[model samples]
Target: MITNEYINRAIDYILNHIDEEITVEDISNYCCFSRYYFSRIFKMETGESIYEFIKRVRMERSAFRLKVEKDRSITDIGSAYGYSSSNYSSAFKKHHNMPPYKFRRSIVHKSMMNPVFRNTQTELLTWQECSEKITVEIFEDCTVIFERYKGSYGDLSVHWGAFLDKYKEYITEQTRILERSYDDPAITLPDKCLCDICIDAPAGCTLENICTIKGGRFAVYHFSGPVEHIYSAYQNLFSVWLPQSKYKIDDSYGFEIYKKTDCGSRHMDIDICIPVK
Candidate 1:
């Protein structure tokens, strides 16, 4: 099994070299493990190969930079992330589905078109190595309103809207509100496609549409990026990061914490929390 020490160190290395070329051998050396062993453990733990993870991270980072640094052009931003030319735009388009220039202009108009939440922007997405650790507290038992659907996250909009509609009514009668996802199944990958809706309620609150999510030990990761890039975080956590983590995955749901522009940064911020044993 991959140990936590190696995963943590590998993440640190990747963050420090986000703008440079990296290889599995580089990571293996850092972990003091043979390349073959490291690769096996990495793939078994994280759902993605090492190369795909690196590319996804780079794309996520570049996308964030494009939004924050408005003065730079698409080509310049791509190059800074090591894209050879604007043609790299094709990869971005496939990943994000919209051109960089268009994405930037939409941001300029002060529209709700947040690049972080948008999955349609075109360009090889870039990842900004987030070294920040998430803060999580343990609670014995919490009630969460949830809905389960079996399908692709790519098609989650319709089902999610239905769940929200049901939740809105429940919230109207409540005082405090909190939300999360339970993805013990890791829906971002095809192998596992379970999803859940979670909310925190008062100690004596009525169950109503709410179901109880047994709270235990949980490890949390905080990230800001397009929703499409969420998978990269999972790849890092479950594939590379988790293998090396001391904790093991617990069966539950993985949910995202969405930041509304009115309350948080204009960018979409999501937290991937998993119940760990």
Candidate 2:
């Protein structure tokens, strides 16, 4: 079983130094373990690596900053989050693709789309009991562009791929003018309707250009995992765990929190937040 002591101590260190250079070695020394041993245990328990975990913590903080701190420049914000000039560029490129400056203008000013879920199946399934500390928050109304989908989500990568390619192109063109992003909320998957969630997009964006998608309110949850196994977490949450919890499922947006995606670590750092009532 995973102990709260271990998780809590790690979290405390992480929260304190979110803006500092963090590594497996730092965590190892803090926890009094060898780097090799700490890496294995963290992966085994969280399904993610130490480096990936820290990057995620940083990215999450950045996201909030982006939403609230309009005064900070992207480079300033990036550096505040412990990213070097090159590192910030690389990280922003991987996540937002068009760099922070342009991406900022689009998200900050727009009326973002929010998806809402009205009804859910009554049947409840049992899952292995495990709880991770999750923080929940509410976002006000906003604007967005999105693409709607319904199908076997596992095989829908082709669709997402096409959408991403177009989204990137749109951002490149509009970067000089505004900050544009392809927001993905990966809810409505297979097993039930085999559905795919929509993408929040920007203006000058069209189906051909990957423009405006949808906008709405959301109740978000953060977690970490490999990209492939992420679906299992959702399955457990929606089908088994959430049904019994006090939180009611709403038809807003559902999205994954992302950290790094590179050869060094394929473990996807994600926050799976679904808008609920």
Candidate 3:
């Protein structure tokens, strides 16, 4: 969990409202602090000024949409964040070193080379085998306390361990360990990935780093395998199964609900839930 309540509140405001026009004054006022004081603490803790942080996050989220939401026009995606077509192209080029259309092209081209498309003799399972693991279900909305992590997904074990240890006193047998991913690993750079290591809010927990996961209809895949193969599982779910299914993905962020884990055995059991329309 983020230790600074003010910074957490500011980040929360930014993330929850990133698609809308945002300003430093809006965040400062939301946290009930002066703009100068809030900006100083935000930079001190996050290593980026409030404006820089907001811009980077907005750009990254928009970049992800460019890759996945192929049917969405660049102008519409930019307009969601209050950017006009010309301004959006300029800002996107400045940060990503390419225009939005070019970035989308690059990701799509790269996706064709994924391991899922490779031919192998008895080395890869059939598409039907992979699709069989997915099922549809309705997920109820829930609030959780989470800590933000910005790095490779492989480093998550350490972060999860630390979170559990730090809040052990508040944890019980009923606690649910879960995570929410903000970027697609295959599309986004490894170091720039963002995720939240979370658990269901503890009893009487007063943590400020809390948010609600949207409840909706989802395609749930029950994945049980080595931690390293988790990414492959997601690829199969999205690339192979999704295209054939009647449903299309919704705008909601997907989350993983941990069923169990075996550190010594190097195994993980979890339900990967993707919201669908």
Candidate 4:
């Protein structure tokens, strides 16, 4: 079996050098293993060939930048991830079933046709059911180590449980437990949604998976109730309060800050922090 340390070092190398050209031989050298042996071990552990994994990660990163960085050119974004313009467009089209430009356009179109926009009238009528006060605050940037999960939002508890168990030793009084959902469930398919279960890590701490949450203005809503009701609270925030507010939701991922949980009572208190501009 391949050792965890070897796999972790390889992953770290890939993440850190994603913007540069990387090859199987380079990874093998970094791990101080033969190329043939490393390739087999990597595939066994990650379920993908090293080349396949690199391509997928680059495409995912490109898709994210295409959606958020409206001012950047598609060609520039493609080149940053080590792809020529033509090759990037062709690969992106094959992977996403649409051209990059088309994909970017779809984002704007989807936002307009979002569930929140369509149900604004009905949401206004039932807004009282979720009438919770929202507060605006300036949040500082945070460094977090996270585990990514892709599936139905309802299944996050399973992921969270596993994450806590795996990283229990890293837990501390100052470590903040948070979840960042990258895609809007209302706009994307439930099974395709991307979510990350993260914990704030101290500076200079290196991990297998880490990302920086950008700091900015945010609209915070506090919810204290059964976990099932959390969806309704979000629906009210997006469909009701957001449309009527002065600020517009930004492109950054929205996160949930877990405050307290009562297993016996099946209740939880969490703050939903949505980035705003």
Higher TM-score: candidate 1 or 4? 4
Better of 2 and 3 by lDDT: 3
* lDDT tens readout by residue for model 1, 1-277: 1224465456547745877888989988989999888777766655556676677667666765565444557788788778866666877776666777765555323322223234443232122232244445454666665554433555565565666676665554453333443221221233333344445555666654455556676667776765565655654554444444556554343455554322233254766666677
Per TM-score, the best of the predicted structures is 3
| RMSD for each of the candidates | 15.1, 21.1, 4.0, 7.1
The C-alpha stretches of model 2 lying farther than 4 A from their native spots are: 1-4, 108-111, 115-277
Model 4: per-residue Cα lDDT over 9-80, one tens digit each? 686577557778999999999999999999998888766788887777667667766765666799999998
Q: Which digits, one per residue and each the tens of the lDDT, describe model 2 over residues 1-277?
A: 2233454356457756888888778888898889998788877765558787687657655654554355557778788887877888778767655666666566422213111221322222253352342445665433333344333444444665565565565444333221111122222113212132234445544453232213344444444644455545554554444545556554333554344334346365655666566
Candidate 3, 107-147: lDDT as tens digits: 64455443322331112245688668888999898888888
Total clashing pairs for each candidate: 35, 37, 0, 0
lDDT per prediction? 0.55, 0.50, 0.79, 0.73
Q: Which residue runs of candidate 1 sit more than 4 Å off their true CA positions?
A: 1-140, 172-192, 201-209, 251-253, 261-267
Query: What pairs collide in candidate 3?
Result: none
Candidate closer to the true structure by lDDT (higher is better), 2 or 4: 4
For candidate 2, the lDDT comes to 0.50
TM-score of 3: 0.83
Better-scoring candidate (TM-score), 3 or 4: 3
Ranking by TM-score: 3, 4, 1, 2
- Flag regions of model 3 displaced more than 4 Å: 109-130, 186-192, 206-211, 237-248
